[model samples]
Target: MYIEYIAMELPRKLIGSLSQFWKINVLDIKQLYDSVEKLVFVSISLEKRKTDVVRSRYNSTMRVPKALNPRLQKQLLLRFGVYETVYPVETTPSRTVPDHIEKPEYVLQKQPTVLPDKAEVKDVNQLRGMRRSCKLAANILAHVQKNIYPGITTDDIDGMVHKLTVEAGAYPSPLHYKGFPKSVCTSVNNVAVHGIPDLRPLRDGDIINVDITVSLITVITLCWHQYVNSLQNNAIKTCGPEVPFSEIGASIFRHSKRNGLTVLPAFIGHGIGRYFHGPPDIYHTLNRYRGRMRPGMTFTIEPVLSHGSKHTLILPDGWTVVTEDGARSAQAEHTVLVTEDGAEILTK
Candidate 1:
């Protein structure tokens, strides 16, 4: 069962881009805030389970016992060439943002936390700031895409993100926020959301999601998933003002089910703006969260779709979330603004 949180107000807008190697598919609703907009590309191909005997990684031929527990079955599957499992490696110290760049309020706090209790209505000036930051975040993601290839560690991507963000006179929002030690999040294959960057080199045929957030006068966040040698699809849709927030998740759930996928309900999109996380608590599954979109409000709608069971677990590092059944997951996100006539994609 999902524990519902008190609904709060927030801003909304949408941002998107299409690449030659990607297919964009719009699913449903949810809202989150940030200057950055995210697009997730998920490519899933389900195959029949194999019962044939196979060679283990140790070069010995063996057959996985059908009576083994699910966890052991997953391990044997990995060993028998179902898919490669991702693991964390030594990560370097957190990269630094320039002292001259503006920082978020949470960075100055002893506990470094910001709890947004209400949705914020953006004024003209605030909206301008959001656009600027969101554009910067999108540009940074485009730049990072050029560097993604086999043998490049996620930590290298983090360094590139940190350098580009600071050089642009903006702060990387993920740095030092709530004690997170990386400037960006890189989740590969079975790893779900909030996968911290480490020394693991990306492999060919690996799929990865790169989540980027930056802070100028306003904070913006965006995420995109790419295949090392393949591609996938993701898209966003906007609604008119006063629409029930719950409808977004319902629509996405329907779309995912129709596509033979499951939505991971544990994580929700959130209200974003000056702060990294805030109200609205955009659920990707059907729920009773109370709220309606209003003009000038901004938020994000990012949903993670799984090719297998939706169950998940957090790593010992307290951040990296992985699929409990070792299934692969994909995610897509965008920050949107509710306008009088309709919603706008700010990060587009």
Candidate 2:
């Protein structure tokens, strides 16, 4: 299994006087992961008024100190080459979907409002629609995977996703949803999530997550990340009936910790069906969100795991989110339905 890493740097203005100190903090993380032979992913952000100190939203156990023993800086530098930062490039206008394709409400609204607090329980017909949408989403993702390699730009991938979903007589859900410009979310290397596809071409050794969503009568979303020219490990797990929703995150957290990785807690899974997103906010980190899986309820579980710090920052685009430390990160997702006996991976 290839563990993902993401790194980010503070804005240039914040690093002015404290440049050396910030570099040391970043190096400390590099050294911490180098000992385990794992790539590290981290995000650092400071309050505008308190630019001298970085703060993390993760619990005490997961927070990385602002400073660490700087003795291993040289060793880390020698082992890991200079970190390359990925930035947004010029993107073409959003593609058009045929009039026959049904669009989600957000397409007309220009923004998806905050979802209702209660999760929707799908009826029999809704479940069938969900299954069909998810199957198509999975197939499209697989089709896109075959075309991935060096020299293919992420915007190219978005075009492919848009064409496939439209050809299947379904709408590309991400289009116009909250003003996202692309048909799919293509998160390269250090971009944790909601990455807007751009003109940047895929390079060897880069990790890219292609998140696709389709809207038929019902809606379904799934994400698949590929490690270019490298083998991938299937690290996703499924849960059975009687499992509390909260425990799902706790278990994932424990497993990631044991494997020398950290979970980016800022993003969580959610209920899906007829809408792009909804209730039962599934926190992938340890949390007290209350609820339990029940038959006929469909949702997504997409936890982003990193090799370094867990903090992240949103770019000015108002959509893309990148790690603060410029480290790499990877993500995978599946839409699932609760069954009487267990859970079924609808996107599998």
Candidate 3:
């Protein structure tokens, strides 16, 4: 006998592909040997829900593939079920995550926000505290950018930032937060943000952007955004002059100038508070964010300008964001507290 199992919970996309593959390859196995006792086909139905969890069920039916063994089929079905249960629902594209493939479940699931929070600071004193956080972030990036080069591993950058932040009696915000595995984001070349520090050495002609944030007074402030824009613009204006930062920074800045592209004001700074990213997303271009800048308001200014397109890629680690076209990207960032006259760079 042969059994046919219905797979009701499978996504239509995968179901379609599997059905086609089965018909073309498995359908030709028409009969079992005289010793063949029974056959079963298990169909698993997958339903995608809002929470990134899938509800799946197994259907058993008589079939050639199923006839191999009941226990084997059961094991296969169980294994697939378990995989669907724990795998992430969203993933980076193949071109982006070439080293490690993301699970299909995560690729299909709902995504969390790119920026985490909308924390606010309403008082001037509170703003000062926020600036302190920004300064820590700024100082950390300043050191990393100055030292990044061909012989330096990304992990070195992470270690340096981690040690510096902790030495200052401050917490490196990204460590163990939301599963980010690094103290700082050192996105080199194509990697954009959240690049895990590895043994990968910075190349002579390569570019990298380091993102840092610190926590102070229960507030999370971002400091890399504005610094990126300022540095990139400055690099372009200076050409081959001494950048004080890494050569990559100068290359990105100088390349941007050659493109004759105006840094879009619409893509500049951002506010931070309870939430990691808040309103009044500042841009380098000349547009106003209705999100008012008030005292005690802390934000990040990391402007990313590309030699070609700003399109990006996510690394296998899930946090690194890189340029898609393999073009160079330059960024400097600073977390700051909004003030009456201007702003205080906390991480500086």
Candidate 4:
């Protein structure tokens, strides 16, 4: 499988142009972000202009376009053999923290969207904060994990997390950030992430990830927002919005093309500190994301793999992500603390 156990490096080609993508006819800018403003693009469709095959999917309002985060390089893809969509975008107002607490050194006048170096090691203070935050997050996950039996609704799990987070004197990190309503992310089998906790009950063997991130606050805010951490093993479960374009997106695409499996290319694990999602984005698929793991740095490296075709669609909620072709998926994750010699799974 995938040339695995084959001791070798092989040649590869990466597409450098958005224009060369097939079926793309028009990609225009409805607006641009000023230097003071982060670039937010109003997404538009090029489908119908290329073929009437695309003319039928619009409400006209659909063409009005929506803003997208600047990190996304390109996303227009062939869809349903007919329909198409440009993913939605969002921006957050600066978060405020107490003046007495010490903040991470990275908070800039302008929120830095760039990621830090890989496997970053944490200083004594940052490590302490991260360790405590991760433990809290893990505790929350463990508290919620007991709810995964058949029939307990996903919303129930979320409610438990929110209540516990508040009681513990921390904020539910995801609530109201980027319009996400749920505090914890409960991604059931087949739904990679951003599965808004709803009334849907769990069934037997339905593996789920109860991702908890608490804004550990008493004195300071890292990056001006709540400093958060995660739980789970050392694999690829993730909190959505934290990861934008996955580095693994490329390899998944190639491997899927070779093996006839489906690959979802939309997300990846990222560095989380003062600002919810920053750089040093961890990629699960193979690509040239240069971030490395070192002591003092923290990030998430979740990669969602599918058993079917990798196509996906944004939900009507404008946030939840799901497979378009009905493929069952699985993911695992952790907030990693790079140590002097190796990596430490804080969630453990």
Return the top candidate by TM-score: 2
Candidate 2 stretches greater than 4 Å from native: 1-83, 110-117, 225-238
The RMSD of every model to the true structure, in order and in angstroms, is 16.0, 10.1, 18.1, 14.0
Model 4 segments beyond 4 Å from truth? 1-121, 218-263
Model 3 per-residue lDDT tens digits across residues 1-348:
112334333344543454544334243332233333332244222332322211121121121123136796565345322111011113222111122322222122446335534435557566656656666676777777677778877777777877787676666667656666566666654344566667766555555667776655455666554324645444323222122213323344355566543232224556665445665465544342343444555655556654334445444446655443344445666555555565555565
Report backbone clashes per prediction: 33, 16, 77, 28
Residue-by-residue lDDT tens digits, candidate 1, 219-312: 6555454431111112235355888888777777777777766789998888888767888788888888888888888888778876666767
Q: Kindly give the stretch of ten consecutive residues in candidate 4 with the minimal lDDT sum.
A: 1-10
lDDT of 2 by residue, 7-88 (tens): 2333434334434445442322333324334335343433232222222221122122232335544443443333445677
On residues 228-342, what C-alpha lDDT tens digit does candidate 4 reach at each position? Answer: 1111232323222223334234534454456434435577776765556666676666567653444566776555666544556555566666554444455655666555555
Better of 1 and 4 by TM-score: 1
Off by over 4 Å in 3: 1-121, 225-259, 262-268, 283-289
Q: How do all models score by TM-score?
A: 0.73, 0.75, 0.53, 0.58
Ranking by TM-score: 2, 1, 4, 3
* Position 255, candidate 1: lDDT: 76
Which of the predicted structures, 3 or 4, would earn the higher TM-score when compared with the native? 4
Q: Please give the range of 10 consecutive residues that has the lowest summed lDDT in model 1.
A: 48-57
Model 2 / residue 253 / CA error / Å? 0.2
Worst 10-residue lDDT window for candidate 2 reads 227-236
Give the Å shift of residue 78 in candidate 1: 16
